[model samples]
Target: MIDTRLSDPKLNDEQGRVLALQRYQILDTPREAPFDRIAGLVKAVMQVPIAIISLIDSERQWFKSCIGMGDTTETTREVSFCTHTIQAREPLYIPDARLDPRFATNPLVTGAPFIRSYVGVPLCTPDGYNVGSLCAIDTIPREYTPSQIEVLKSFAALAAEELELRRVAQIDFVTGAATRRGFTVEVDKAIARYGRYARSSALLVLDLDHFKKVNDTWGHAAGDAVLRAVGAKLNALLRATDVLGRLGGEEFGILLAEATLRDASRSAERFRKAIEAIEIENDPPIKVTASFGISAIGPEHATADQWLAEADLALYAAKRGGRNRSCIAPSSAETQLSRPA
Candidate 1:
């Protein structure tokens, strides 16, 4: 968790976090070459038994790739030398973990893995969040020249820049979703081969109701909280296969590939409830809600735009009927209801 008491250094830090992590295409991925090469070189050059390209996430420091290690790819940030390295933004060289005040009792140093000596370089994102670290660890104390430390930090910066550029290229800055350009490029391939590979797909358009009221009554900060809340709900409720993106302010879009209208509605209703349950904790206290419209593509549909429009129309009808409800399309038919009121 981010420390709430201290003034946030980067307000946009969380916005790009998901996107930055995703762009690496590294998490949960099978271990591979590029990162392995870097890790291998760290062990060879630094003469340490362990080297890792570690990415610190919300809960843990996960290794994108590693070498000279087995069955110990990640650990909590509380026990990480990388966490301190990130904050200091300098090489953290602990010559003797048992004697240093900052690390004397640290678990990773005193407990299993018994790190007696450590050196780590912070990996910073472009706008400057310390996203991770490149570290070499030894079981015994060691000394390194200042020049060697500088070189390792330079390499960490290069790796961080590579990861940051990928996020800048593919994600929406505001909502942490794939940019429309990125989504369009990918969605076409999915639709073109529709049933040949997968079944039908569904599109959903969501509009937050009384959003202007939130901004008017509480301020834009409150409005931002509402938007982030909505995004978080959709992100949590949707399946891994579904693609969710914020189309623009107060409006979001989703693509549920291989999902039927019923399946889409089920997922949509879950998100609806999730949003309704959220109570934004901004000063003066704020409560927010949303409405959703859904449309599914059958074999007869010709274009993605058509499906999006259908969802939008249904969303409009949902607004007209009432806020905080869901409307499913084919406007001629009675709208399908989600959560009552």
Candidate 2:
């Protein structure tokens, strides 16, 4: 029931810290095994029932890896001891919550988990923002040894490293789309769901029309600008459930969950129109269009590669039937005829 207004004095550069934290995009995401393992190991080492990898959001402390919390995923920032640790930007050790004036009145201290002792190390980002903490909590108060503190610090650093590495691996460097590998992994899972539930899904494989001409005439820099713009446009067209990735040079792939072939065609048309509308105010004002090949998940396709090949065949048909259009493949084993859009 305490207000945290101006209470956490050590929350340095609040705006920058928030921006850095958002860059990780770890909040509310499914618990990852790496983070869970860290929390589990910390719990084992500290012999505590409660251990978590917590991210301090604007209004709450959200656990990315929670163990022994009994379905409690988050707590309000006002009562969060992890929030205090993040503000301090260092390990916070409170042997007895009742003995500490700061936490004695906290609801978590008086209420659930009845937190009696806590030792938390700040998970600092590379740019010096303390985003959250890797913490161990005990219902009964106890002191931590100096060796225990060192081990906890190492674990916190390990969690930070993993978060950063995963962030890099998830995104495409140039277009900010999912990387090819990331997209492939996601598609595998999506296909598995489609197989189990027989859900309708669509794949679109697209390539820029006359992309090499842009690279040759306007140079690679201009080509990169076109690619970046197109990538952004395609991303905007996607739903939250859909995933698009830069498959490779001048090519991108989209996986539309629960979408039919017609839905896929409609989406592809939108992408083509969007790219065609991009008038780069260059010396000559570069304009571009893209060709799309759409394929629905059917009995013929079981793997990501097979689905992509189906889309590629349709895309080639789009290029052949004149560029700047979408072509959809029939549900047959081979792409015999492509329906142009």
Candidate 3:
């Protein structure tokens, strides 16, 4: 008889555990080449059909990059075996899921995506918390040596290093969004993909409304707080494929890959509302608004700078008409702007 049991993964200091994970500030981020390369390397070297850089949160496991999984990027925490790996802080190897009492009854094994063998190495941070795992899965039972587990740990080390390196290079120290240079690199790739695949894309350049007044009245410290809050709010609303960056002080940019102007407009309106709703809890409370300019990318786009210029024009129009609104550039190459939306 096959052993069958439903195991409930334990959560320890789950609040601080989540806060520790957030310190990396990597959740819901766009796919990066370094991470994708690692996942692909694991799939090829380990000879598995599926490999993923899985980050486990309170309710779900999100894959920043995956190999052989197609377009699917995540699953609920209940179905995530990585959840168990993180709890051990070491590699968890299951030669076969069906025969394992801990996982035999799990939906991931019995359901459509029938997972059999699994090897997961914990992604441990310098501060000694395992936020997630680097996992490879297949639909067949297989034997893997401890030596193989060592190699998995080595690859996971590289991934952790890449995460830290990107945090220093790409992330804004204050807002925790991509810096201007980092954002440009990502946007360039999106533009190339749009040109090659004929995918819909949009860019938004946003300037905070009356930011100078905040610095003058409440002090630059409060101004910094406001920017940080805005970045956090906007980042939450983005899809995993979307990129948000600090283009400059009190101004930001968002690259909406596989999205249209109508979608961009709705996002802009949402931003407008969210910004208006922010109430900083100082003695003198602070509230703010933003002006957004939208530009749709075309197949023949030349450079990131050119596209940004188009969106900048649209933003200028929004400011000219009045603040706290969004506008579109009307065309890709032209600097001509349209009326505020």
Best by lDDT: 2
User: Model 2: per-residue lDDT, tens digit, 1-341?
Assistant: 34332564436577777657765756777878899999999999889999999998878889999999888899899999988888665588999999999999898889988999999999988877889999999999989998998999999999999989987888987787888887877677668777788887888899999899999999989988988888888888787678888999999999888887768778888888888999876998999989999988876777889888888988999999999998887563233244344
TM-score of 1: 0.54
Q: Model 1 scores what on Cα lDDT?
A: 0.74
lDDT of each: 0.74, 0.85, 0.84
- What TM-scores do the predictions have? 0.54, 0.62, 0.58
**Model 1 lDDT-worst window of ten:** 331-340
- Please list the residue runs of candidate 3 whose C-alpha ends up more than 4 Å from where it truly belongs after superposition: 1-155, 332-341
TM-score of predicted model 3?
Answer: 0.58
In candidate 2, which residue pairs get closer than 3 Å at backbone N, Cα or C atoms, i.e. clash? none
Q: Write the per-residue lDDT of candidate 1 for residues 94-181, one digit (tens) a residue.
A: 8888889888899878787888888899787665566778988888888888987887887787777766676577766656666665
Kindly report which residue pairs in candidate 3 clash with one another: none
How far off is residue 239 in model 3, in Å?
Answer: 2.0
Error of 2 at 158 (Å): 5.8
By lDDT: ranked, best first: 2, 3, 1
**Model 3 root mean square deviation, Cα atoms:** 9.3
Q: Choose the strongest candidate by TM-score.
A: 2
